[model samples]
Target: MITFPKDFLWGAATSAPQTEGAALLDGKSPSTWDKWFEMEPELFFDGVGPNDTSNVYVQYKEDIALMKKMSMNSYRTSIAWTRLLPDGKTLNPKAVAFYRDYFEEMIKQGIEPIINLFHFDMPWWLMEKGGWEARESVDHFAFYAKTAFEQFGDIVKKWATFNEPLVHIECGYMGDAHYPKVHDFKRAIQVGYHTLLAHAAAVKAYKESSQNDGEIGIILNLSPVYAKSEEPADQEARHKADLIYIRSFVDTVVHGYFPQEFIDLLEENQLLPETQAGDRTIFEENTVDFLGVNYYQPLRVQAVENPRFPAQSPGDFARYYDWPEKRINPHRGWEIYPEGMYDIAMRLKKDYYNIPWYVSENGMGVEGEEQFLDAQGVIQDDYRIAFLEDHLAMLAKAMQEGSQCFGYHMWTFVDCWSWLNAYKNRYGFYRLNREQNYARSDKASSYWMKQVIEQSGFEYGGHL
Candidate 1:
């Protein structure tokens, strides 16, 4: 049987907008999502929006207790920027009080809290000013980071600058999945570059403060790239895909600079983002102390004959091709590839100075999960259990091969609202009952997770 380190952390993670229901309550202002839901309600699934979440705002106490019962020693959650700084600058006293009480309760229950600064919930006021593409937003975000550090840095020792920075840029600028739906490669690069700047700025602010000595990091959703075949064309296509999808953020945050080839390619197309003075110094000086990896699947790239967009953006030089024979998660429409977890770990070990890291967000989402409910009021989510077991085995293998992985926090604790997809896909241990006033019910995987946490390892053939 494989055993994890004695101090290995096992918990669940959730973002603010995805779980907290009070979108505009208690001196909280509207985020980009709040404004988007009002303007385009039909785009959301089941007509559910940000305001209709797990109501963690009012039920965090009970939620923490549930976490305790589940044997979660660490709980990863983000503080909504709008909730803390209603206008992105001014502090909301009520919001501050709520978070202080909420975090203290988690600590009182002996649960370590990992707080993330930004998690796709941009304040509506900031988005109007070009969001991450604007240079001014960098300083604005730095101010919020400083305020958060000063306020909660004592209680929160582990901090993350941003969660899935690439997702916001891809969904918002390069694709139509998020707000300000503009499909422009140039704008996407600008948004991505400014986001890295904001991260570095936040790190700078955190270090400048005379607060408690704590750890800071960034969470990246790294999807390893693979070529469809050994053909030169496919390999070339895969290289470009890696440059855009993988190296774009990983290289910067880990290595403190953009990939040289990526810069040359963008320069060739004149899609380079506007930059300011001393930005390089900020990046060089403020690198993350740790990294949080969110791996879901790998990208299978194949050369496209008649490329679109002049090979300037993702899916232009090469497009993702699904392997038909590969295992698939029918519920969420994503490939179920556990090997990608090991690939990510090895890549970090070989490429990024072997920095300490953890699996920050990895979980499966199933639609119509209520159908799995049994007579005992528990959801028989054996599929989730199997998924976790497979991935954990792979993670354990990576650790054996010398990967510095300290924890594993699944995508969420309780089934919460997802952006755009809404509540259509459930990725929580505790199922949320929509008809019964958002009641929480334990799923089969929840019990399995409890054992894994308490034992600090999952023995082969142990209660499966």
Candidate 2:
């Protein structure tokens, strides 16, 4: 049987706005998501928005108890900036008390809490100040990060500065799916640069502050790209995709600088982000202690003759050709490529000096998951169980070959609101009943996960 290291951490991840429903309660202010919903409620699935979410603010205690029951040794969650600093400056005492008590309870139950500072929920006021595109916003985020560390650093030692930084740059700035939807290449570059700088600044503050015992890192959603064929053009397409999506963030955060190739390409296109003095030193000195990888699928790419200016946000610099023959997650319209997980780990080993990392967010979201409930009232999520097993086996193979990955946290804990998609798809091991006051019930996958945690691993089987 395959097994993991003795200290392997098994847990689930959850973000604040997706789970905590007290949008306007307890002196909390509006997040960018709240404001977005107000502007375009119809954009969200079934008109459900950020205001409608699982009541984690009130039920965190019960949730912590449920985590223990699930045999989880760790948990990943984000603190809402709007909740802590209503205006992104003034500290809300009530927010502080709630967070301290919530974190304390998680620690008391023998669960390690890994906290993330930002998860796409910028304070509405910050967005009003041009968000990450403005230079001043970087300092504001750094201040928020320092405040969080100063307040809750004792219990939460594993801190992620931001979750999926590239996602924000792609969706919010390039694609029209997220808030502040602006399809501008120059703006995307600016926002992305500032986000990376903000991350570096947070790392610097963490080091300069009294909270020096903990590690700070960032989470990135990485999809390994493969050339559709051995053609030279296809290979070039794959490289361009990697440059924009993966290496752009990985190279800077881990190596403390942007890749020369990326810089050259930006210069050629006149799309370089505006930089300031000493920004280079901040990045060079504040490289992350660890990295978080969120992989769900591999990107299959082929070259195109004429790439468009506004290339669907991320694909702007490269052309994309689909793999029609690949196995598919019919429920979610994503490719099911378990080997991508192993490929990512191997890349980290060879290219990034094997810095310690973990699968921070990886799971399959199924549409209308409640329909899978059986006569006994249990959701038979055999598909999800199989999906995890396939991916975990790949991760296990990488670890045996010496990848420095220490933990594996699923995408989420409870079924909660997904941005734009809302509650249309559920990724949680524990299903939520929206009609019944957001009551949660464990699915078969939850019990299966408990077994995996208890055994520390499982026998390898062919991908489902």
Q: What TM-score fits each model?
A: 0.98, 0.98
Location of the lowest summed lDDT over 10 successive residues in candidate 1? 455-464
Q: Clash pairs of candidate 2?
A: none
Model 2 Cα lDDT, one tens digit per residue, 254-315: 99999999888788777888998999999999999999899888878887777665343446
- Stretches of candidate 1 above 4 Å error? 308-312, 461-464
lDDT per residue for candidate 1 within 1-464, as digits (tens), equals 75788798888999999988999888899999999999999999888899998999989999999999998889999999999998877889998898999999999998999999999988899888889988999999999999999999889999999999989999988788989898889999999999999999999999998774999999999889899999999999999989988887888887889999999988877888999889999988888999999988888989988776545567777887778778888898898888999999998999998899999999999999989889999999998998898889889999999999999999889999999988888999999886788889899999999988888887766322
TM-score, cand. 1 vs. native = 0.98
Provide the overall lDDT of each model, using Cα atoms, as 2-decimal numbers.
0.90, 0.89
Model 1 clash pairs are none
Number of the predicted model whose lDDT against the real structure is largest:
1
